[model samples]
Target: MIEALAGPQAGGVDDLTASDLLALARDRKAAEDRAAADLLVVAARWADLHPPESIHDAAAFAVPGCEHEEPIAGQGAPLVAEFCLAELGAVLGVSTTAAKKLVGHALELRHRLPRLWGQVQAGRVPAWRARSVAEVTIHTSPTLTVEAAAFVDAQVAAVAGRVGPAQLDRLVAETIKRFHLADVDPTQDPEDGYLHVDPRHATIHSDDVHYAGTMRLEAELDIADALDLDRALAHGAETLKALGSDASLGVRRSAALGDLARTQTALDLHTQGATGIRDADGLPAAREVVLHAHFDATLDGLTTVFGPTGRMEEGQRLVLLDQLRSWCGDSRTRVTIKPVIDLNADLSTPAYEVPDRIREQVILRDRTCVFPWCTRPARGCDIDHVDEYDHHADAEGRPQPGPTRTSNLAALCRFHHRLKTHTAWRYQMTEPGTFEWTSPHGHHYRRDRHGTTAVDQAEPPCPPDIPRPRRP
Candidate 1:
């Protein structure tokens, strides 16, 4: 069946029987598992080649404070050179962050979870399944001891590494408890056991807004608070119904939350007015939201038969114009319409510090980090000078090599910014909103408004200082 599906003369996929198709799919999946296993082997070898001892002298590339040891790895995992991740990521067409995780998982499995790793090598378990187990063990709270990780490996190997996420989590928890891996506090609350971890959190899923201009909210509040909020929502929903709102109960309840926010803003404003408190502008404080909505010029001038779709810069989601109008029309919401700046025009500052106008231009231009495969929003990122800014250019009376300008600035998340600053990775703004990046391994990639693309595959120059591991 493998020969029929994957060997020479395998082009007749349309003529294949249903059973043949199923067999082909299974064969392809098996091939993928083998490839994944091979990737792990390569990642492990890469880690071995760039061990801590190899890059000890290269202090600039080493992760700060982890010169002798890699802090990202598990207890029993091998230490890898901190700067090695970017080159590997470039070669493998993945993000440096992803490559680091891959190396961490490989080391965790090969050393900390030997049985599972062996099973992966023997093809009895898929590499992904084993890696999943390694991920859990490596990141357990308080950190897993060598013995605890070994216990997890034994349990997983017994099941041929066919553990689901929930089952794997439970296994890690059990192993931690069995080995007493977590630190125990003698004076802590006995009812909470040795673990004093608090799981309560209220999270607003702002990054995952939907196309309908809605966001998901989750919370784990105290029982009394939860009940009180529920009662308030119910009361607000009833009030809306009384005010002739024909929306469904669920929709009204959702709207009630917004009402609650507006109500709180109003109460605060009322108190400020009663107290005769005002800002420099002589106005009471109000809830304000800045929303950037982009509309195409050719789209009927922001009106259509239904309504033009707009892109919200905050969440990078498509939102209806109607929804935006509804939000702006809220009684307590203050909307400030700033004058539109021409994105094509370049803005510059004489000093090294970037002006707010230039920063906003950079954010609006690049929507996210300019690094390859980095999705961190530009608004939260640092506006990095594509060319290194010279602090003493004016003092020295020399030409400013790197001026603070819109064309020279690009947004980079903190980690990638550090990586660009310290590592061999280098990038330049080839054009406005377009950056060309060259990794340590001589691989070139381009990132622009559209996304990242591999631009060059030049032969990597050897770093004479870094030693290569001997192959067996």
Candidate 2:
């Protein structure tokens, strides 16, 4: 019935008047409400998933304004365009083309100014008290709408103070209550840990069968004692496993063990029920833990927890369990690569160590990252082996692994650990404590350091007048 009334068929219903349109309005109103609801749902979903520009496009389709058909048809296209151009030129005091562009800008400010005026009449403020603040505050940036609104409120409060402070406070409170409430900031830890994790690329072969990969999560944790790390790991793993299963519904996972280098002690496999820990009431408490496990499906299921939950007991306990799951659920991790520089082709092992008694000897030398153009500190770098000890043959009968030695070792941070694999770049030992780096284009870079004294340079000659040559 409502559809018929809204459709062209309604023109034949002579008994129907504009008032009867409301009588058939029930179904029409319901349909309109559902349409609006559907629109809002789609708008929210689009905003959550898309960029702002895309959201604007979605909004244009979702909420179109009434068309001015009569004005365009009566005026004729060229005459209407000319009139619009002339009117815009007069308003902006510019050429018609420039005026056309400025039309939207004028309407935008003109539209918002009335809202400011309404707030003033409602005991908010007159234009005199607010325009200066509003101009600076609102026109400052398109992003600071809240700031602009705040400036309006502040200006009103100042003027109201001259009239009556109590009345002004009530007015401010009422405006906030009747209009919009500002979001409160969440309380968090003073030291927040931010991790940027890039997952290693893994391929699933045609059969969806694959064996793979490595530990590569980074965290900022206290190097010294404050929290029980092992327990935390267990709790974290539990949390992550739950998250992987249901991302939106589950808590963040907490474990940190898989990413850090481990010695593989039997303790790595141990699982114990919660026993000693307790809450303030002295009841049995849940413990934090992580245990390793494997799942054969896609690796995209992992969930990461990002913040500290220290004070909320129940939340902390749950978060800790999730963390444990994160650590234990992952069965594999990416391998860490290191770089080594070898001077001798046959020698093996890259460990560089001077005898303890000769400690003073090594320090008088090398100062920084040994790599060409790198300024990394030498103290934090690893002394890497340039070659492997074992020699293996390929199916075609070729020597596989080469030898290694101290002369092959070079200092590198974790970042540049695998950078030496580039085919175009090569480095050679010029002499002890010196290296010459050559680029693909034949460019050269030299890195050198000297000890307190040269080993081969002759010691200062003995006093010429005395027994300088007596021993010889």
Write down the lDDT of every candidate, Cα atoms only. 0.79, 0.36
lDDT of 2 by residue, 160-202 (tens): 4233433433433333333334332246331221111112233
lDDT of 1 by residue, 35-71 (tens): 9999999999999898877763454443453324455
Identify the leading candidate in terms of TM-score. Answer: 1
Off by over 4 Å in 2: 1-365, 386-402, 450-472
For model 2, what is the alpha-carbon lDDT of residue 398? Answer: 66
Poorest lDDT segment (10 consecutive residues) of candidate 2: 67-76
- The positional error of residue 15 in candidate 2, measured at the CA in angstroms, is 99
* Model 1 alpha-carbon miss at residue 39, Å: 2.2
